[model samples]
Target chain A: MQKISPLRSSIEAFNKFKAARLNKADKAQKTNQQSQTNPFGITFKGTVIQMDVFEKAEKVNENTQKAISLKEKMQNTGKLLASAWVGTINKFSSLKTNAIAFGNKIKDSTIAAAKKIRDFGNTKVEFDVFKYNVSRLQNKPVSELRTMLSNELQGVTNE
Target chain B: MNNKRVKNIIEALGKHKDEESIEVLNELGTNCPIDEIREMTSKALIRKNTHRALELMIVNKGKGINDLSARVAMCAINELLALKDKQEAIKILDDTINMHSEKEVQDTARSVKALMSFSS
Candidate 1:
C-alpha cells in the first residue's frame, strides 16, 4: 500500500542479483569440491581420503633425524675446536714462562761470575803484582825505557 | 802492549825527573804516529814544568801548539794556559819568537804569548 522509492527499488534489485551470484558461486564450489585434484595428481570426490599418511610421517621423521644429527655434529666440531684452541694457549703460556725462567737463570749466573772476578781482583796477590810491576819500571835503565816506550808507541800506531 | 800498560809507562815517565825521561818523551811522545800519544806526551811534558819541557812545547814543530793535529795542539795550549807558574812558559815562548829558525814557530809563539798575556 506504500509508495516505493527509486533508491529502494534499485537496492532491492542489487540484493537480488547478489543473492543469485552467491548461489551460483556456492554451486560451483561444491562441483569443484566433488572433483578436486590433490598436489600428488590424485582426484577425489566429496570427502578427502587420508592417502600416504604413514609414508609422509616416515619422511618427516627421517628429515627430523637428519637435522638432529647435523646439529649434534656441528656442536661436537665446535667443542673440539674450542679444546684445541685452549690447549694451544696453554702451550704458548708454558713456553713463555720457560723463556723467562731461562733468562733469569742466565742473568743470575752472569752476575755471580762477575762478583767472583771482582773478589779475585781484591786479593793481595793482585796488589803484589801491581807493586812488582811499578818497582820494576822504576829501576829500569834509560835504554830499556826507550825501547819499551818505542814498542808501546809502535803498538799503538799499528792498532 | 795493552793500552793500560802503555798508559802506565807514560805516567811513570812523566813522574821521572831524569834527563833521559825528557829524551824519551821528546822522541816517543812527540814524534809518535798516533795523535793521542802526542797529546799524552805534551801533557806529560807540561807536568814536568821544567825549562827544557817548556822549550820543547814552544819551539818544536808538530809538537804541542805547533802540532799538525789541532786536538793535540789545543791540548798542549790548554795545559800551558792552566799552568800555576807561567813564567817559564812565557820565557820559552819569547825565546821561540825571537830565536827560532822557523817563521811558523815564531808566529805560533807570538800568538801563544798574546793569549797568555790576555789570560793573565
Candidate 2:
C-alpha cells in the first residue's frame, strides 16, 4: 500500500483552505456591489465598488487587527512545528509511536495558522479595492478622506 | 440639554418631512443662536423640502451664516432644481443669482440654470 505522507496531505489542505478564503472574498465583493453607486452616475465598465467609505474604513481596521493577531499565533505555531521536526529526527524509532502522533498534531495546527494568514491577505485585497473606489467615486481630497475615515473609525470603536 | 432636545426634534421632523416641518426648520435655521443647532436645522430644512431649503439657504447666505451650511443648502437646491419645471427652475436661479451676494452660491445657481437650458 502506498502511504499518503502527512506533509503532502497538510499542503493539500492548506491550498484548498486558501482557495476557499479567496472565493469567499470574491463573493462578498460581488454581493456588496449593489449598494455602491458611482457618484458621477457613469458606472465604469468592470469597476467594482463594494464597500462604502465608512464600511471600507471599518473593514481596514478589522483586517489589520486580525492580521496582527494571526501573526502572533503563527510565530508560536512556527516554534511548535520546529520542536516537533527536531523530535521526529532525533527521537524517531525510539519513541516512533508518540513522535508521529505529536508531529501530526503540530502539522495540523501549523496548517490552520497558515490558512488564517492567507484569509487575512484575501480580506486585505478586498479592502484595497474599497479604498480605490472611495477615491475614484467620492473624489474627496486626502485630508477630507482622512478626517472622514478617522470619524468612521471612532464611530466603529465607540459602538 | 435644551439644544440636544431641539436637535433631536429637528432630526425627527426632517426624517418625517411633515407638512409643517419646513416652516419650523426654516425658522430655527434662520434664528437659532447656537451655530450647531442652526446648522442642524439648516440640514433638516434642506432634507424636508429642497425648494423651501433653497429659499431659506439663500436668505441665510449673508454674512452671519456658516459657509458650510450654505454650501450644503446650495447642493440641495441644485438637486431639487433639476426636478423642478424648467421655467420654475429658471426663475429660482435668476432670483438667486440676482438676490444672493455669495459668489459661490450665485455661480452654482448660474451653472444649474445653464445646465437646465442645455438639457431642455
Candidate 3:
C-alpha cells in the first residue's frame, strides 16, 4: 500500500524470485546427499552371508575358453582328414596309371621278341640247304631224279 | 620235307627234257595230295609241248583241264591257251573231243578248243 517507484518494485520482485530459486536448489542438493549416503535409511545387524560370485564368473569364462579351443582343434582335425583322404586318392590314381603303362610296355616288348624269333627261324641254314638241293637236282640224271622225287613225294604223303 | 623245297623240286623236274620227267610229273605232280602240285604239274606238261604231255592233259581222267579241283582245271586250261606253238595241243584236243570215252573229258576238250580258236 506504500507508494513505490516502478523500477524499484520490479528489482525487488526479481530479488525475491532469485532467493526462492536458491532455497529450492539448496533443498534438492540436501535430498540428493541423503539418498547417496543411505537411500532406504535401513540397517542390517545380523551376520552377513558371503557368496563366491566373482569366482563362479571367472570359472564360467575359463570353461567357455576351453570349449572354444576344443571346437577349433576339432575343425583343424576335420580339415587334416579331408586333405589326407584327397592325397591318398590321388596317389592311388597315379599308381593305377603307372601299373597300366608298365603292363602295356611288357606286352609290346613280348610281341616284338616273338616277331624277332620268327624272323630268325625263317633265315636259318637248313632252309638255305633245302634251296641249294632243289637247284642242284636240275642237272641230275632223269632216272636218279625220278627215284629221288618219288621217295620225297612218298615221304610227304606219309607225313 | 619242307613244302617250299618240294615246290622247288617240282619246278626243277618241269625243266628236265627227258621223257621220264613226264612220268614223274604224272605220278607225283598230278596225283599228289596237294592241289597246288597238281596245278604246277599241268602247267609244266603244257610248257613241255610234247605229244605225250598233250595226251596226258587232253585224254587222261582227272588230269589237266579235267582235274578234280576246279582251280587246277582252270590253271591247266589257261596254260594250254597261253602256248606259243598250239599245233600239238590242238591235235590232242581234237582227238579227245572225237574219240575220248568219257563224255566229261570230251566236253572239256571241246570247250578248250573253242576258247583257243577265239583267242587266236
Candidate 4:
C-alpha cells in the first residue's frame, strides 16, 4: 500500500485548480473572439430580426389603416346615400305637387269650356256642344215632342 | 366510434355550427389529413352561416389550397351585401378569384367588383 503524502496531495489539488482556471479563461476568450471578430454575422442576424419585426409592424399598421379607411368610407357613403334618398323623395314630392296643380288647371279649363258651350249654345259658335248635338241627332227619336203631338191629336179626335 | 359514426359526428359538427363545430373543424384541419376531408372542411366553411368560415378559407388560402365551390358561394353572398360588408366581401372575392376556372364566374366577380366600385 502507498502512503499518502501531504505535499503531494497539496500539489495535486493546486494542479487541478489551475486546469479549471485555464478552461474558464479559454471559454471567456472564445466568447470574446465571437463577439469581436465576426461583426458582419452579428450585424446580419440583428438586421434580419429587426427587418422581420419591422415587416410585422408594417403589416399591423397596414391592417389598422385599412380598417380605419374602410370605416370612414362606409360612414361617408352611408351619409351620401341617405342624402340621395332624401333628395329623390323631395324631387318626387315636388313633381307630384306640380302634377296635381297642372291637373287642377286642366280640370278648371275643361269645366269652363263646357260652361261656355252651355251659355252660347244657340249662338253660332265653333265649340258649342249643344248645337253640335242637336245637329248630329236630328233624325234620332224625339219622344217628348211625339207625346205632345199625340196629345194634340187625341184632343182633335175627342173634339 | 366506427368510421361511419365518426363521419356522421364530424359532419354534424360541421353543420350544426357552434364552438363544437369550430373545434371539430380545427381538428379536421390539423389531424385528419386527407384530401377529401380537407375538401369537405372547405365546403363546410363555404356553407357555414357565419364569418368564421370565411376566416378559415383565408387561412387555407395562405396554405395554398384552392377551394372552387367557395367562390360560387361568395358570388351568392355578393348579392346580399350592404355597404358595410364591402371590405370583407372584396377580400372574399379576391381570394375566390384565384380558384375560378369558368369565365362566367369571372364575369360575375368582375360585375360585383364593378358594383362595389360604383357604390364607392
| Predicted structure with the largest TM-score when compared to the true one | 3
- Candidate 2 per-residue C-alpha lDDT over A1-159 given as tens digits, one digit per residue, 9 for 90 to 100: 999999999999999999999999998777556645543433447654433642545344788889998999999999999999998887766688888899999999999999999998787354434543422423433344334433433343354
TM-score of each: 0.51, 0.29, 0.52, 0.24
DockQ of each: 0.28, 0.02, 0.31, 0.00
Candidate 4 chain B, poorest ten consecutive residues by summed lDDT: B58-67
**Which one is best on lDDT?**
3
Name model 1 segments beyond 4 Å from true: A1-140
User: How far does residue B90 in candidate 4 sit from its true spot (Å)?
Assistant: 4.4
Each candidate's interface RMSD (Å, one decimal) is 2.8, 14.6, 2.2, 48.2
**Comparing candidate 1 with candidate 4, which one achieves the higher DockQ?**
1
* Candidate 1 lDDT tens digits, A1-159: 999999999999999999999999999787667545433434458445444542555455788899999999999999999999999999999999999999999999999999999998897564534732645676677677778878877777777
Clashes of each: 0, 0, 0, 0
Q: Could you tell me the TM-score of chain A in candidate 2?
A: 0.23
Going through the candidates in order, what is chain B's TM-score? Answer: 0.93, 0.53, 0.95, 0.46
Put the candidates in lDDT order, highest first: 3, 1, 2, 4
Q: Estimate how well candidate 1 is docked, as a DockQ score.
A: 0.28
- For each prediction in turn, the share of the native Cα contacts (below 8 Å between chains A and B) that it retains comes to 0.36, 0.00, 0.52, 0.00
Clashes of 2: 0
